[model samples]
Target: ETVDGPPGARTYRRTLRLPYGIGIAAVDERPGTATGGRGARPGGWLDARLHLTDPRDLTTAVQRLRRLFDLDADPYAVDARLGADLRLAPLVAARPGLRSPGTADPEELAVRALVGRDRAALLVQRYGKALDAPCGTLTHLFPEPAVLAGAEPGGTLGALTAALADGTLRLDPGADRDAATAALRALPGLDDHTVAVIRTRALGDPDVAPPGTGAPDDWRPWRSYALRHLDVAGEPQPRLARAGR
Candidate 1:
């Protein structure tokens, strides 16, 4: 349970990348109750307040939040598809409601792919935008591609930033996957693995099988979810064998 806002209440808060600017939102998780031998019913409503730098970005902010949390996914459908695979059936049974997590801003994910987490922290410390009203540890908005582009965030980073800043590269959730993959491949210093990762996490492509697993054709359109289940079940994922460990 979360520990902010009020006693006996759990609140989750985070910074979001809106179209015009950045935003911070706080949402409370209301408890669920079982209805007399029936399943539990969600109690609280999805009430969230977004504090944005620009008031006009409300719509964009909401859209970004939905993408960030992957609220659009149909868990039942995904589980059913992956559960059809014999090897994955058992794992799917073990975890009936697994959902793939996605990022709000594709550009930020691309930058993250280029610079590892440690370096990302350092970059944030040095260059990220400070929120007007800081919420606990939510001190800053991630550095934007334009901001990083101006700072010359190294070679591969530089190319990525330039592309992102100028719109040469698009990572929006609705962006064409094939085109995005091809564009990423054209950039210097990017490998197929990195591109695949971007496809999975940033774009929220549910069917991304890591390069060279020869994942069967049947797993199409939901392989990313399968990969997550395999990882959780300690099954061998040969495509990302070393990294998965």
Candidate 2:
């Protein structure tokens, strides 16, 4: 039951629940303060954001949030662990230098550079534009391989359809990222740009190799996402130091 409360700041959104259970809420609280400015906020069962301070903690947060939202009949300890595991801001402060910049239009760079303007334009118009809505921000959920694979010879959806028709661009979720990147690179008509797009955005791999490209220095785990940053920032994608490593 909510109908406006104290004459204070911040529009507190509260979800009532059993006393011992967690009552979900969010406030537009001021930085370092419990009070927040009064403003209407969207309400839902969940809210998420990348803190950008530490990668390991952020990854742990993702795992914990997953369990928190897991609706199985299992006991609530799963969610409690998430709460307990929530690392304080100070602890993360010491562990900075994580999560570099990210992508703008990885697809655009990949399509235009590798696939050529005409074909890339068609592919972007067909699948690239609508990818975000359906696939969300998750790179692994990019459009199907068949469509992209046949994007050239068949038009936009043509390559995709062809890939689907023939078994060349298998859309199996179980496909390995490295193998998928290799397979995408092997498919006909695909140049560096297009293959990189498939590997980084489609396959959710940051370490995809550009065709006939240069050295591959290690950026450790954030390779693909980091490449995405380079692509988005209009900077050249980083070269992999070791070939095929």
Candidate 3:
């Protein structure tokens, strides 16, 4: 979908794997050619992806995405409750707003998160054009905190990046969700959004609040999964840009 708004109005799209007997729907502003834009480039954008088990639910999922961005929207009725497959990507091109990349390696998305806007520009600048030297780096989900911690200001990563890097402060695999949240909260510069990313990715809790917000109690243990449901069922979307990646 082509989402226009703010100075950074973004476009999103998704790649579909239409399998027989299964339903699938995806929307993107421009799934192709997004990666080739960013840093000194004016059209840099972030790409997000969501998949549903039912194909008839595409309209519902697209609506939630619109509402998440604060556009006046209404969605259809659908019941998609799978989360393990939702994929989100951001195209950090040097542009005013961002566009989504079709389907890319999770690692590239991870690097985009590690090196945010200001710093990502610097990284691109450091390469002295071509935005190369690390154009397509990929690694595991929930990247090493230290990797983000090492980012240079505005040029490497964004604010509160350090807290995300702290080993003790970050949530790792199989960690206690509550304790992880507390630790993240203790970090002086830890932003509400970063903390939420830690909660969901590190702990795999899915209970992490979007940005600084909290999830409904009834959605516990599968909040992330529930989010996909709402996203596909045309339910209200959460304000997540402020929370996690």
Question: Which runs in model 2 stand beyond 4 Å of their true positions?
Answer: 1-160, 209-216, 231-245
Model 2, residue 28: distance off in Å is 16
Cα distance off (Å), candidate 3, residue 82: 9.8
lDDT of 3 by residue, 204-236 (tens): 444444753345554444455455444444557
Q: Write the per-residue lDDT of candidate 1 for residues 29-82, one digit (tens) a residue.
A: 565444535565565344677888899899887877677666788878988888
For model 2, how does the per-residue alpha-carbon lDDT over 13-100 read when each residue is reduced to its tens digit?
A: 3221211322222333222323445664433233444332234354443433332233121223322222232221222232222222
RMSD of each: 4.7, 14.7, 15.9
The most accurate candidate by TM-score is: 1
Off by over 4 Å in 1: 1-12, 27-49, 53-55, 239-245
C-alpha lDDT values of all predictions = 0.79, 0.39, 0.39
What TM value does model 1 have?
0.82
* TM-scores for candidates 1 onward, in order: 0.82, 0.37, 0.36
